[model samples]
Target chain A: MLRDITLGQYYQTDSLLHRLDSRVKLTATLLFIISLFLVNNLWGYVMAAAFLAVCIRLSHVPFRYMVKGMRTILFLLLFALVFNLFLTPGTPVVRLWKLTVTKEGIRMAAQIAVRLVLLIIGSSLMTLTTTPNHLTDGLESLMKPLKKLRVPVHEVAMMMSIALRFIPILMEETDKIMKAQIARGADFESGNLIQRAKAMVPLLVPLFIAAFRRANDLALAMEARCYRGGEGRTKMKPLVYQRRDYMAYAVLLLYFAAVIVIGRILPI
Target chain B: MALKLEHVTYIYGADTQLPVRALDDICLEIPDGQFIGLIGHTGSGKSTLVQHLNGLIRPSQGRITWNGRDIWEAGFPKKELRSSVGLVFQYPEHQLFEADVFSDVCFGPNNLGLPREEVQKRARRALELVGIPEALYGQSPFELSGGQKRRAAIAGVLAMEPKILVLDEPTAGLDPKGRDEILGQIAGLKKETGISVVLVSHSMEDVANYVERIVVMSQGHILFDGEPRQVFRHKRELEEVGLAVPQVTDILHRLSAAGFAVDTDATTVPEARDTILKALGGKWDGPAAGRGAMGEKEKC
Candidate 1:
């Protein structure tokens, strides 16, 4: 059951988005998220939805794969929906048992829900198309300017890539530990909250120890290989923006401008 | 108790873009008190097959039966199945988590909800069974050496008193001496207890030495299942699947190929040594008497 997690998981497929520059994709994702907030009216959301649909189609990633990420934050989405639907101060449309539903509240809730869903799908698309190595390289290159300000950009990127690489390894380890415990007749299911939490001790203690041991071994191996914290490093496959990346930026700019114009001119 | 798998198949990440068929149509019967070696290269589904024996993961296709009853059927008592078919995973030492060695061993029996005294008794006996000293029982498992930690981990599963013990690459990553010591203890336990053992390993020599039956797997299919000598006789076939025969068996085969009057059926060192010595004895008499008749007859 633990295998179902696909967060930060890269889908290997050759497509336009997959071939584009990681820095371009990363910057586009950030800009898209910013524009999502700038959107206010129905036409703005319509334009955003159209752009997302086209992007998803062009990327060739299965729609369900992107939707799966939304499941993890379903509760947060529902909470925001409820808050906007019930608490927004506007004209009340329906009242029952000390609860009021306003027309404006309905509009606000729909807008918030769309915004959250689009935000999740947009980010998931970026991760799905790009491998973790490329993602880290992209992040490090984007953050290179921070080095002038004495920020440890390389170290941070190294740490991120390491963490990303270890996620699946640690997950597999957890699954093994859980099975070993199960073989010994430890019941993880069919327990109350506290009982279940208590049962996790056997699993967690060993996992933490294994994780630390792995980290220690990795550190020693790195030191043995003369790793000196990302200094004097060269990339095997350096990132460079291609013509397609500029084309993608042009499309993104057109979409962003359309959303801004719609948000300004459209009546609420 | 006998464990029977009928047409069992397992597919990892089923319904995903790229599903992997880890086990396909695997049919085998593991009767009680038999020591069977399951040998396969990496990604050969040896671990997946062992996990199915105890119902840790249900079969994606077929049924697993214990004593003529489907284990996944309603009211199969999964906890009892798990305890009865204990699996010692690879690098099991990483699973040891209790404060002390004794308590950690006790965890399995404790999970069985047995009486405290019974749990303690089983824990102590298991520790002793694995040759862990009494003085080290109170020490934290984390403080033990690598080999000791591995033994403690094995003891944890042994405390459950399984009818069929399944170990997946139990001796991996240990020094030669440590590997032999652990394998020796496991063989000894099987002999003393008369419980069926499914030892999942890739080392041909180790399996050839201890297990009576060898099951060779490749690409989720059981390629060969027979006596160690019988399986090793198909040296070319085994090698084709990226598995080698026992070193002694290989040596014997080479000797036979070199036109020596030697028995190539020996799977163990002692058997190969005796075979080679018998051939040498015959050759010594042949050369002394200046007659090749005796040696030729022996070869035939």
Candidate 2:
């Protein structure tokens, strides 16, 4: 039952986006999200929508998997849409008993909905195509220049990678603990909110202890292997920008430029 | 009373793209007070089948009946079934969370809404049954050693006074002394209380020594189900599925293949010892003289 909960997990498949360097995908996602806010005109939205569609297709991640992440935030999207549609002031399109649906309100709701959906899809594409280790490695390499300021970028990256690695292990532990507690007649489903929260005490306590123990063991094993703060450590497969990576960066820049230029050129 | 699985099949991720058939039309029955060993290699669906025994995971294509009543039938006494068939998970570390060992053991009986005094009484009895000394009962469960922690976890389930105790690899990752200590205590507990036990383990030797019946599984199907001696007789087929007979049984098989007049189905240590001694002239003076005693014990 716990296995059904996916944390925007990576989908295993071979495609052009999967073959590209992690840094390229990460940078492309960032640029795409930035352009979502900048693009206001109808043509600009069209360009952004087209770009995302192509990226999703190229990534080879199932559309349903990407949309699953969107399902969790559906409430937030609806809230944003309702707030924008009824609260914004402009020419009235429809008048209800207590609220006015204005033309500007309609435009605002559409714009925000498009941007939010595009943003989620774009970011999830990166995660779906890249493994957690590669994503953190790319983040570390991208932030390497900050080492001059003693930012501990490598350590932060290592911590993130370890945290991601433990997600599934901890999930399995939770499943085991939950079943064990259930067998002992612990009632989790029928209880009121307060009682349900109280019932979680058995589950949460063991989970926290298991997580801490695992982290402790991991640290000791790393130390035993002479791991000392990632200093002068050469990676077995070091990050290098291949031809596909450069092509991806160029395409991303061109798309963002088109979106910005269209927003500026189109007055309507 | 008996727990029965009739054509039970469980498919993991059934609604997802990559579905896996974890249990495929398994049919088994567990009668009262029977010490049954569920032997399977990793991912042979032993854990899934154990969950079915207590109604934790409902079968997708079949039904599980407890005492002639469908467990998944509407308004079934599921809570009662769970308490009746206690499950100790593979690792004890993930289950014990109370401040002290005594309280941890009390959790199960407490969940059953037993009276306070009765809960304490049952918890104390369980701890004693598992060989947890009273002096250590007040200590934090986390402070106990690995084997002690395991025993405390088992006591937690046992405090519920289950008719059937299903333990999944209760002795995994322990020293031999710890393994033997825990298994021996469980054997004694079964003998004293007459509680049925379904021990799920990959260790042939451990199960052979304690259980009356062994059920061998391969790829989500039962391959063999019979007495330990009867099941180990198919050692070649068992090994093909990444499971082997007890080390003693394998040694006896090799001895018999080498033309030593010995039977290959003596799975336990004592049984194999007697079998080998009787083969080699029976005149060797050590424990060979005690063959009659061992042979007499096996008569039951």
**Candidate 1, which segments miss by more than 4 Å at Cα?**
B282-300
Global fold similarity of model 2 (TM-score):
0.93
lDDT of 2 by residue, B59-97 (tens): 999999999999999999988999999989898756888
Chain A vs. true chain A, TM-score per model, equals 0.96, 0.93
CA shift of A234, model 1, Å:
2.4
Error of 1 at B157 (Å): 0.6
Taking candidate 1, what TM-score does its chain B reach relative to the real chain B? 0.93
Which one is best on DockQ?
A: 1
Q: Provide the TM-score for each candidate, comma-separated.
A: 0.95, 0.93
Cα displacement (angstroms), candidate 2, residue A160, comes to: 1.5
> Candidate 2: lDDT of A124?
80
Instruction: Give the Å error, residue A9, model 2.
Output: 1.2
lDDT by residue (B56-109, candidate 1, tens digit) is 898899999999999999888999988899899999998999999999999999
